[model samples]
Target: MDSQHPPSPDSEQQTTSRKRRGIGRIGWAVLGTVFFGSLLLIGILPRLSQRSELQAAVKEASTIPSVDVITPRRAAATTNLELPGSVVPLNQTTIYARSTGYLRRWYADIGDRVRAGQLLAEIDSPDTDQQVLQAKAELAQAQANILQSRASLAKSVSDLKQARANLLIARQSWERWQVLVKQGAVPQQDADTKYATYQANLASVEAAQNTVNSDSANVKAAQASAYASQANFQRNTVLQSYKKVTAPFSGIITARNVNTGVLITAGSGNSNTSSSTSNTSLYTIAAYDTLDVNVNVPQSSSGILETGQTAQITVRELPQRVFRGKVVRTSNAIDPNTRTLLTQLEIQNSDGVLRPGMYASVKFAINRTNAPFVIPDSALVVNAGGTQVATITKDQTVHYQKVAVGRDYGTEVEITSGLTGNESLIATPTVDETEGLRVQPIAQTK
Candidate 1:
């Protein structure tokens, strides 16, 4: 109790603090006001101000000058269209073996020129030769049989003659005997015997006639056999010639499939044992002096292509060389699958410079027309609608006129329609320029 009065000052202060709460109401209110004010200014106000400034910039840039300037002028041009096509030979053929035989030798080979009826190769037909010999033997046997039959016929004829003589002598003897009997110089029995002898002689003469007829028939049969044998022998000899092979036509030997000692099977049903063996060709020949190119044209362009049309062919192998040709023929019907017309072009290659199966490009000029307005391709502006050329009117204003374009030259285009020749055409136009825009004209320097 003694210090209580003095401690009163500091103690009284501590007691007073305890009596109050954790924070004052005024301090809480002030903190809440400051947080809400900062959120509004930092987040919402800046977005509003930025949006206004962006809108202002957009409006300002929209009014800026857009395009550069270009002048219009006129130029002369020719219109021609280019078509894609390949070069081809006019004629081609593949050769195959016709007969089966051992390839004896090849006289002609690839790249060798051959004439019509020239021997291409020979076959060793030992089998065919043996068959011929066998046929000849059979023929000789037939001839010998014929000779034997002829000799038998001759003997029969002699016998027939002798029998007729015997009959004549017997008849004379019988008549003499009969006369003697009647004159009482011969006996009756003897005259009867002479009559019997005369009958016997007549029978012998008839028998001899029969033998002669048979012998004549045998002789004819033998002659026929001999003729048949001769014919067979001749056929055999012809078959033996199959060993030699000849070219079917005059052509160069473009292919050789067989070499010496290669066995070639006879083609078709020809028997190797027959007198005539089928001659199998060992080399294939083709006439390459002329070349043909087959082109498939779309149906749309088919109408313009016809026989005798002029064409130019360029070979890929020989790029610098261009061969002149004409449309030799065409398949009048269009192919359904490809919807293309088949056309053929012929070119002469007498020098043999153009080989078969070489790739080539063919160009055909289908239509040619005079263009009223022709200008350089650089002047054209292509958009979604169609092609157009920027033209300058007399009032010095630029306008885009839609135009129908025809053939295209390397640097120029043909205006088929929608343009008058008198209008000034722009050689170059700026993309930023719009229709109806005023432009300053300057003559283009060629």
Candidate 2:
């Protein structure tokens, strides 16, 4: 606001020095601001670039899916096969009477153990006894007739010898008479009478020879009759032995159809008897020293079953017991309708714990030469292309491989034709995990 005055020299110098110092301070301040701004820009540019790179890496990692992988496991060599079977006695039979008679007494009853040739019952048949006696008498009479005929034959032979002697004498006399007639030493009538006597002697000799032949034929006929009578007697004696009922084999009697004084018919005729109408047989016997189990093996497993193969048998009634047996025989032919093989297994039942007609379950251990691989059901992928399994390649890429299934367990499946049991399989594959897609594999814990 005041008017300016002309400056002296010293004062002018002082004002000039002060203006220079203000200019220097402004220049230093501008330089310091520029240096600090450059430093800040340099630090911010590198950080921004690093942040961009980190974001890019995170985005790339998010694009690839992570998956849990498992290796396929191999199946076991032996498989257990279970089947139903029927238990039966080794030998069973229904005994019947061979002769018709009333049961007098029974030595064996139901549930009785008997040995071979043991008497079970006896029948008192008066008719059969009388028939046996009559046959014996007829045989004796026939033998007597044979003896008488033999004596008559001897007498006839002696008569034949006498006849022969007389024939020789008559022939000699006839020749002598003819010679005398020719020589005219005797009368013609006497010579003719001697010739007639010789002819009569010849006729008598022929009759005697015929009588001897007839008597010899009679002896032969009597002998033949005696032989027939003897055969009849022997047959009757055998029939009489049938009155005693005996066991043909050692066994246990399971049934008793006849008691004392019960009328029994011969053979296995009609089952309707006056005593009991329940069964046709006199007794049912079974030899249960051993037991037989019969099972029908399916065609799929028939080839693996063989004779001498071991088996385990179990019954529902005997839940705690397991019986061991072996394959004894087979039908050797397949059933057309059932498509099964009839197999028989034998088991020793010396303890008598098993009975006939019992239901049993038979288990067989079958070994497989070509065992397949087993994989979890979750690893399987079924698509329009067919059955497949998702696997991870070495390069961490998704791969879908075709697999053929064999046996299906509930939670696992058998790979029969596809897998080599060395591939890393995905535990579960999603739709996004297509073939050839890159994925990050994580090992799955069992």
Candidate 3:
């Protein structure tokens, strides 16, 4: 009641002044609170916004995968081309019998060294020997017949002379008899008788001349028969010489198919004359002084190929050794079916260490004109657009880089044309990776 009592004019004025001062203090406090709150909001709002932006940036960075990046390297000035080939000899031939006979003895066996004209085997050909003797006898008989015919020809010439003499005498007598008959120097019956005698002499001369002509024809027929017999004798003699089988050329005997007692036919190994191979080859000889390799060079490497070019040859059997050789000859034509060039390379195997028919690998040294950049094989990618590689930009975005590739090394490839050496390429890009995809590029270690 005392706190709520009505005030006198002086006291009431004092109370009102006190209440106004209190309200003023309360208003000042409210103003200070509002000002401080405004300052705090102005200071903290920008920091909160900055914190949100940093968090968003961190999230964006985590979304991208870190990838290894590589740069291209220069290729070598020279390149090696490897291909498969087979070994062969300079000359090889299968021996055959020139005359049908039974093999008597073989001086040369498999792996035996022989010289040209050396006896390789002997044949027992009793039939050929008897045939030769018969041919000689026939030749001698023909020669005797020719001599007898020549004597007849001599007689024919003598007869021809006699006939001519008789003809002259008969013609003169015929003229004489006609003259005497016309002159009536003798009796008519006597002159007629002389004319008849002259006519008979003329007929005798004609008969002798016909006999000479027949003898000449006989001589010619005998000479022709003698010539034919001589030819047969010469052929038989040549056949007899073939009983001793001699090496046509110096070489090593690679095979001996005929035993000492096997029967071999004539022309059995002549590729053109004989198709019957039922008789095995008497001998197989090969000249291995120089080893030859036959290889099919790819068509793509034809432009750089040349005769007499050097090459390197190796075989699995001779792993530690290498054979140096040169290009001997080429078919000069690309095989359309295989798309390769048939080439022959020769190597001097004087030591005889290399044998024919060995499987070999050949290497050809090639000079590269425009050596391309070498890149990791894993960097290449293929898609609908063709072969390309994934490259990273400055902003960590992947870009598709089209590239032309050449020869392939096992883990690397040659880039013929495309990027400079400065591009950062993804070493291993997944199939899902594509152009414009974000990535984190990390430098690759060697």
Candidate 4:
């Protein structure tokens, strides 16, 4: 809009300087834009590439399942087999009266230790005492009868001697008469009377001899009666001795069924001939210097049990104490009903800590020639096919192995077959797991 004018040198120089300054500013702005764009491309491209690589790795890992694996370990050669047992005394019995009577006094009681033949109680048997007195009186009467019979025998002998003298005198008289009659110096009637007198004397002598033999027989009968009376008296005295109850063996009394004045009957209360009766036994004695532990061993382990095998016994009441014992006997024959062997163990109980009728556990250390492999219970895969275990191969492939189970140890199970104890086993296989399944095996710590 202004009028055209001729340019001056100063104006042209100023214009040129302004144009050069604008061109320099444009070039610097273009260089700044190029440098900032290069920096952004360098930072964003690396982030995108790393994100894509991470996504690919995650996708690949999701296809395979991670499995926890464990190496199989061999079980111990000698394992402790624990079983239930019942404790009892080595010798136990119930004492009863041998004679029927009333209890008079007691010397021993429950928990009293006594020696053999020690008196436990006394019985008052008036009947036995009276019988003994009667037997003695009868024995005395028999002895007196024997003495009287002997006196009678002596009198009979004296009579026999007198009769023999008379017989001799009569024989002489008869001979004199016979000689007189033959010589005609005496009458025949006088000879006949002399012969009759001789006959009478001979009859008296014969009667005296018979009386002497009867006296001798009476004396023998009296002596035999006296011997029988003596035997009866001795038997009564022996019965009286039985009135005193005594211990048959050295033991501790466990029960007292009778007190003073209680009527007791003869015979044993524990005899198989009768059922159990109350107040029948005077006392129950048990020998506890040694204790017996009875246990029924299972059939699987019974074959290895024998006498003299060491055992360890523990009771719940005595938790801290471990009683050591040995097998004393075995039934040898198995019980078909229970499929167990009755085994008895004897333990020294000098301290008297172990008692009868206690529940206890017995442990036996059984050594095996071939120990089976053991695995966690979770490793076993039980199904319709059979018992199996999930194992991993070198290429991380799952293989189900059939295994024969031996003993069940609660948390673990014994593999009697199908394992060499060198395979890697899956600790906890899932239901989805199958044979020849590819998995990522991860070793477990335990």
Q: Whose lDDT is greatest here?
A: 4
Q: Where does candidate 2 clash, by residue pair? A: none
lDDT of each: 0.72, 0.88, 0.85, 0.90
**Candidate 1 lDDT score at position 77:** 39
TM-score for every candidate vs. truth?
A: 0.49, 0.68, 0.71, 0.63
**Native-to-model Cα distance after best TM-score fit, residue 13 in candidate 3, in Å:** 50
RMSD for each of the candidates: 25.9, 7.8, 10.2, 12.2
How big is the RMSD of model 1? Answer: 25.9
Please give, for residues 229-332, the per-residue lDDT of candidate 3 as tens digits. Answer: 89999898899999999998888999877766666688763222123344546788999888799999888678788888999999999899999989989999
Tens digit of per-residue lDDT, candidate 1, span 1-446: 46544566888888778666445666778899999999988998889999888889777646643333343223333322235555454443444444445767768878888877788777777777887798789888888887888888888889888888998998999989988998999789998998898899899889888988987888788788878878878776776676677776666777666666666665422223223343343455677677787788877568767789888788767878888878888889999999988888888888888877776778876554443456788888999868998877787777888997755666876677877676676667768667887666566656
Model 3 has an lDDT value of 0.85
- Tens-digit lDDT string for candidate 2 (1-446): 88998889999899999999999999999999999999999999999999999999889979888999999888999988899999988899888877777888889977898998999988877777888999999999999999999999899889888888887888888789889989999888888887887888888888888888999999999999999999999888887898898998888998877777777677742254354443468878898789999999987679889899999999999999999999999999999999999999999988888999999999999898988899989898898989999989989998899998876778998888888888999998889889999998999987
Residue 137, candidate 2: C-alpha displacement in angstroms: 2.6
Looking at model 1, residue 137 earns an lDDT score of 90
Which regions in candidate 4 have their CA more than 4 angstroms from the true location?
Answer: 1-66, 133-235, 268-278, 316-320, 334-338, 392-399, 436-440
Ranking by lDDT: 4, 2, 3, 1
- Native-referenced Cα lDDT, model 2: 0.88
